[model samples]
Target: MKVIIIEDERPAYEKLVHFLKRYSDQTEVIGAAQSVQEAVDVLQQKGQQADLLLMDIQLADGLSFAALDQVPLKKPVIFITAYNQYALEAFRANGIDYLLKPLTYDAFSSSIDKLKQLSGTFSDPLQSIQDIYKKLSKPQYKERFLVKIGDHIHSVPTEQIQLFFAEGRNTYLVNGAGRRMITDYKLETIEEMISPEQFFRVNRSYIMSLTGIKDVLVYSNSRLKINPSFDFKEEIIVSREKVAPFKEWFGGGI
Candidate 1:
């Protein structure tokens, strides 16, 4: 199979390549692109040479779906993303399968198998994916979180959350009022639950809300330091690699 990968994250791209190589020795990676514009260019120029596309939903420039809009892609796409909210949109844009981030080899293999099986069985494979998508319900983000304090439960709206952080092994959330509470969900799961427009995982340790940001300052090593509205014991620094995407997200560019 001739494949093209469109992913902004270097680690993810490398991992996907590793998985592809493990899946089949015959699978040839024809090309790779990162941004939406680059993806559009690659598809327009090399779309005929490729049989399949392994695409990431979110890119540094914009959503990968925009590339599909600019170029009429006839190739089958398997969208891989951290966020589940775009599943319906992925299916609408000729996506045969949707795989979530931290992708397992089993899931990747199954999606490839499904793509091959569908293509061999049906004349219009993408139509079958769309039909299945229509029957599914749209993904929903968490609106409210229930926290327990001394056998008493309180419901806190998602908008009231200032930030989420991990301490040792436990995850905690701080409200707008600076009240900290423990949550059972991991930072990764919380990342998927929240809207990207409102929340950004500045680092592996912290996920900050836009409304919670008080100031942004340049830190050492080309990184950024975030000052949240609430008090935090540890210094919250954005990783160097995430600086560009953090700036874009902070500026409302994406």
Candidate 2:
């Protein structure tokens, strides 16, 4: 069967290509695409000659599923995604099978077999694609933030972080022991990595950890001021809309 592999990572694309060549005589990869744009172009150029798509959920530019909205493709897709088991129900519901990353040749073959068994084609795949997109768009509740420090990458345990603040264009992470370190992520990106039970983004510039909160002082007109034990020149203020949720989060309503 003619196949198109749509994966963003070069190493992963090469590995899958090598394995496809080695694993099965039933499948033949006709073309390899690195991004949604590339896949769309190849599809528009090749049309129905491309029989199947070995797809990845996340791409370097954006989610791979978003490609469907832009390009009209009817080819069956067997998804390859990093382990996000929360999305399996939607995958199953949508009549598509997914292979978790670090996939073995046997597992890959079995998934293909399963897809072939279930009519060998996906119908309304974009609906499931939309569901996956919706789930991924929201904050994925993760436990820790991966912080890259110089040459070493560290998982700064979420509980150990005191506060996150922005200066100019960079964001800094302050830990419980009064140590500050530079983080590569922007404020909004880091916000998704933190657990809402213990962290709150008070404004566009700051996301403070619960462990760092020393006191909350009521300010003018229902606005609240946060006093963190860490040294700071300006007081952290909570917007009026955030006060209720902030209180609920701080009060352990997680």
Question: lDDT for every model?
Answer: 0.88, 0.75
- Please identify model 2 stretches exceeding 4 Å from their true place: 1-19, 22-26, 29-77, 80-96, 99-155, 229-233, 252-254
For all predicted structures, in order, the TM-scores are: 0.53, 0.53
Instruction: Indicate the residue-level lDDT of 131 in model 1.
Output: 51
lDDT of 2: 0.75
Error of 2 at 207 (Å): 0.4
lDDT of 2 by residue, 78-171 (tens): 7888856536543543325566677688867776666666565555667656755664556545566677778988888767889998989778
Best by lDDT: 1
User: What is the TM-score of candidate 1?
Assistant: 0.53
Model 2: lDDT of residue 242: 89
Number of colliding residue pairs in each model: 0, 0
